[model samples]
Target: MTELAIGHVTTDCAHAADLAGFYAALLDRSVDPGATEFFATVGRESGAHPVLMFIQVPDRTAGKNSIHLDLHAPDVAAEVARAIGLGAKHVADFAEYGAVWTTLADPEGNLFDIGTGQA
Candidate 1:
């Protein structure tokens, strides 16, 4: 057996609650009530295995993120539009590896990619 499994991805923000709400809306998940002011988690009701956690920090300096998420969706265009409507800003759209994808930034300027699950 593997010693490790995939865990949640964490994001640092000035306002953990706000960022958690943003992601909750975008991902169609709910913010877990166990979260505190400085930490929030977006998790599914069925299970708490995979989650996105937000941690509040005193200062949030602007800089390019070295790591980002790549989400796979059945309809990339629709998902991108929905994310934009939920406050994500569109960055770019491109095709690579026989797949089409769009880049977007969250409210706090965290960049993520949405792509059609094609190869």
Candidate 2:
């Protein structure tokens, strides 16, 4: 059997550098110096087991994102507020599952989820 080891996930973006910087700031990590026009990686030493990779694309994104990132927070309400203040637009709110999660879209229209649960 072949063991699978996850290293990183690269998300496609219309503006590579700009989107990469946004994530870098959000995640509080610097973009890898060796990164190129195609991709950027962050969270190399933030104590988070996993890292994020933002990939650049030439075309502009349109419509809704087919896939999105789901984030966990201890305080969903507070986190959602913070995210909104950071240019994220609210898409939906579901609070009946003993958990509150909000879907949001970034400046490039890519969707990501933020909620309270897990670490």
Models, CA RMSD each: 1.9, 2.9
Query: Whose lDDT is greatest here?
Result: 1
Which ranges in model 2 have alpha carbons more than 4 Å from their true place?
Answer: 34-38, 45-48, 59-63, 96-98
Local distance difference test, candidate 2:
0.73
* Residue lDDT tens for model 2, 1-119: 87986677668876666666766765556776666767677765554446777788777567776767788877888877877776778899877658668888877778888887643
TM-score per candidate: 0.88, 0.76
| Residue 107, candidate 2: alpha-carbon lDDT | 71
By how many angstroms RMSD does model 2 differ from the true structure? 2.9
The positional error of residue 105 in candidate 1, measured at the CA in angstroms, is: 0.2
Q: What does candidate 1's lDDT look like per residue over 13-95, in tens digits?
A: 87788888888888788888867769988884447666788999887667889888888999898999999999999999989
